[model samples]
Target: MTGLDPELADATGKMLTQAVAEVVGDDPPVEVEESVVLGNAAEVLLERSCGAELLVVGSRGHGGFSGALLGSVGQHCVQHARCPVVVVRGSVS
Candidate 1:
């Protein structure tokens, strides 16, 4: 969650988790972590990516050419990730 207020972020995160649980019926419990950041999201994702086994991200973020297969974030992570990276691209059905 990106918010100026940490309290608000925390509340929103909890609410989101609960809502996800409602939609994720019969699935095993999932672990979730929320970070309140005011900086670049790509940087934050990279910083937390040091020892991950796999880094999966969208092929394109909310920027640049809409027809491009990869965005700045995907390119940066693909180049900097310690492990393998997967960039998923799909049409909105």
Candidate 2:
């Protein structure tokens, strides 16, 4: 996962775990590696896409609506990911 701020990465990971549990019932054991990429969203997505089975990301990030309006990382992944990409959007409830 790529986050401009390190603090946000922890929150993002928690949110992702919860969201995944909601859909998948129980969370599976999987290896998650976090990295810091200092670049644009497109660049980040490109770096991870190579040789990846699937690139998963949140639909809306820390920027919320502003990020949505500006085309989120999810959007960039959808367009550029070499393999299949899953974008998870949080629900109101």
Q: Which number leads on lDDT? A: 1
Q: After superposition, which runs of candidate 1 have C-alpha atoms over 4 Å from their true positions?
A: 1-3, 11-37, 61-67
lDDT of 1: 0.69
Clashing pairs in 1: none
TM-score of each: 0.58, 0.53
**What shift in Å separates residue 82 of candidate 2 from its native position after superposition?**
1.2
Give candidate 1's TM-score: 0.58
lDDT digits (tens) for residues 1-92 of candidate 2: 44357677776667867756766665456645445455776777778889887777766544546456335566777887898987765665
Per-residue C-alpha lDDT of model 1 across residues 37-56, encoded as one tens digit per residue: 56686787788778766676
The model with the greatest TM-score is: 1
Computed on alpha carbons, the lDDT of every model, listed in order, comes to 0.69, 0.67
Worst 10 residues of 2 by lDDT: 61-70
lDDT, model 2, position 17: 72
Off by over 4 Å in 2: 1-28, 61-70
